[model samples]
Target: MTRSPATPLPPPKARRRLRESAALTQPQLATRVGVTPATVRAWESGRTTPRGRKREAYAKLLKTLAEEEAARLAKQEQEREREREQEALPEPKPEPKSKSEPVALTPAQAFDALYAFSAPALVRQTFLLTGRREQARESVERAFQTAWERWPEVARDRDPVGWVRATAYEYALSPWQRFRPRHRHPEPPPADPGDRTLLNTLLRLPPRHRRTLVLYDGVGLDLPETAAETEASTPATANRLLHAREAVAGRLPALADPRVLHRRLAELASNERLRAAEPPAVRGGGERRARFRTRAAIAFTVALVGTTALTARTAPTHYEPPVSPGQAVRGVPHKVAPGSLSDEELELRQKLRDQMQDGPERLSPRLE
Candidate 1:
């Protein structure tokens, strides 16, 4: 018997939205469609197309889900129209503007505002990474400190929250943390048995996989954004995320759904009292650290300049020939006292004394 014709399907994005609207996970839909989760993901990503019976099943499921979604949207719109008609309230008049212009926040003030808004939640997020309450709090504080130090770069960033989150996660998951004095032992486990199991399972994954899971599942970043933040390609990030999910699901099957996993991650993080330091303290510490580094750099530069100057001053400007070593004369006579004179010397002295008066002898007495 010949197979039935393959059913046409909506685009990948529409298929994904339809599945999400139906509250069916990729794995769930895959199970229903008799395919692997990765196959469903591939189909959603448009990497490959399904054929034959599986294609028909997936298309059918998506059609039903899309029809239901359209009906739900229509019902919600109708309810909104009824509420609007029933209420029929006038829109409030615009408030009068003051003559004075609004004040702009200083860099410090803006930094503090961002810190106050983001720190508490970030501290809890880091706790999921390190599982140590103190370390988590410290990680967030240090990230903010770095942000303050590089405030210009951070403020210019399109997503300052992402910048700080990445910094905090890096610090929390640093391998050097294992060698820290405080990290000689693991932190106390959560009181809830389920929380303990979840935390343990999370920690058992490689650091990169754990971070990938937290970014995608815990923090709700999209696949592309998660990939970018983790410095991995989209395909590599998806693989990491899949493996992480499989590992997590293996330990606690209840967390198989990403939505449920997201909620549980929040709950798990919140179980620890991971309180971040005050913004003022973070700001002060950052400023102090910045000042110390600046001063040290200045001092080193000054020392280098001074040393160079001193060497230049003492160095010779022109070439000078070196002195040659001394040597002995080969044919010089020996010295003698008058009482110890030799016979030839005595005879010569007598002849010179005798010939002094003769004019011719005196004139010719050169070497005689």
Candidate 2:
């Protein structure tokens, strides 16, 4: 047997939805429709039907609102169904662990690792800063020696490379190096004209600007890290970097790019053999000597103080004026006799008299 088609729902229920969707209250809807709100409510409740123009407008509004609501519901249902399908499927397996895990290093091993990794870069950076290969090598070596000497503290530091960089930078800038005869020798010009020009240009910058540029771009440190290494505030570091970039751009337009600078520095560092160089010897003597000097100073100071106190107490007291009012009034220079002589003159006269009395017996012959 054939089934009958389902009847469509009445527009009265849709009238309320249409008004709601239109964001209009019954009073507002009534104002729009030019009818009382009670009449609008009656029409929505299916107790009455709008007639003529009102009927036509109400039916059109209801049709449009009903279609929009149907589309929205369909979209919501589709999303829910998709979520259900996704929930029904099996979850993916977690990735497998790698076969080899990183091994933890001891302090010495860690220091060795850092020395191997950072020496070449540090040497290259120092070379750029100082424009002297020997000075650069010495600075880097001295910095590493210091690191090795205090490996435990260095290893515990957040950025050991930064620490070494700061140390090497300071070492490269040492004023005493100017006085050393070896450092007095003029550096041979760089082989590459480009390198020479770049080095000269970099050297021309104020030391702080040069240091900021190198630490930020050359060493690839972040602004805060760069600031910390350079001992400047972040804002000051940023300003220095800006001025440094401007200066470099004015001189070498091509090398101003950070990537190009990094590449050029890498090329400069490539041929330098870092791995073959031995780990810097950790000398405990400096610390021992420092401690010894401190103890010696303390002992010397105590001995000096004790000696001063003993002398103050045991030594003869000189004649001092009394503090009494009468003595203060009486304290004055006494008049001396016109023929009076100093004690030294009197002593000399007495010695002459003795010599005169002794005569020829006391006289000793002087050799010609």
Candidate 3:
């Protein structure tokens, strides 16, 4: 006789995967997600499917993982939305007043507003760059306030924060320039120190190099953003930053050890004394926004140099021999002329003269 049909088994494998993915103990997960241990075990063993809360929690966890994956896409969408809003917003026209009337803002009012507006960002940038939590905050605030008095020119630009950032960065670098010429700190030869050691090494790097390194590696900027900030191209910026890192590395053996680099960073953060004892660089206001233009100018200069080098390679170098007292006849060289020169030389000279005479205006407006 034929046997009765067997019941389909529950999915134990799916339940076990849920527990593993959540990284929870079986009893703990069962309690948290509101399921009995036996039920959890049965689900994992494929003896039964979880109903109600258990199934819901499992679905919820999977949804959470999926959400993490979508986070980048969501951020990109938000950025696009912000751009659209900025584009759609009408430009604020100057107060409809007579051109003869000056728009006056009191220095005190301007200073206070600017200081308040930029202090936070400036402080954060400084702390990120130097890893000096307490001192940098004050310095950044001071730097911004000092620069705010000159905001009239800065406000005219599209991006004033960039200008301010560049100015503050320069100020940070100024300390290296002022190191006593007669008395220098002895270089700590080789063998990297702990986290505090590396942080100190980073601080010792010159301002431009430090800023370039921090902006590229610390801030996670691509070449263009870095070039925009530091006024160097991707290649130039990359080289300068890498060189700065190398300089730091050369001083200590820790550069060879990735663990030391990270450890030193952690140690510096933990060392409250080091963070607090450092002197402030700026006084109150933020760097003016026009500073980015200065960076761009620097990058532009580098580009010009590169262009010149390229031009030199392909350019024809026709050096003119100096005229001697008795060497000239019709402005052509005697060596290449008639009598002493052959018939072919004369033809070549004549052709050269004809070409010069008939050629279109070399210095015409079109060329200019």
TM-score of each: 0.58, 0.51, 0.34
Instruction: Output the number of the lDDT-best candidate.
Output: 1
Q: What is the lDDT of candidate 2?
A: 0.75
Local distance difference test, each candidate: 0.87, 0.75, 0.59
178-271 in candidate 1: lDDT tens per residue? 8889978767799999899999999899999999999888888888678768876678999999999999999899999999999999999888
**Candidate 3's residue-wise lDDT over 1-368, tens digit each?**
99554333324554454456555666786677676664554455454555555576755754564465468568889999998889877878877778898678765565455556665555555654555554455455545654554667666533466666677666555565346452244433223345455566777876677788666555455565576567554567778877876776798765545445445544444343322111222322133334655788999999999999999998979977888666455877546443477899989988888875667766746554
Better of 1 and 2 by lDDT: 1
The local lDDT score (0 to 100) that residue 316 gets in candidate 2 is 77
Cα deviation at 75, candidate 3, in Å, is 39
Error (Å) of candidate 3 at residue 332 is: 74
Full candidate order by TM-score, most accurate first? 1, 2, 3
Candidate order by lDDT, decreasing, is 1, 2, 3
Superposed model 2: Cα runs more than 4 Å off = 1-107, 271-277, 280-368
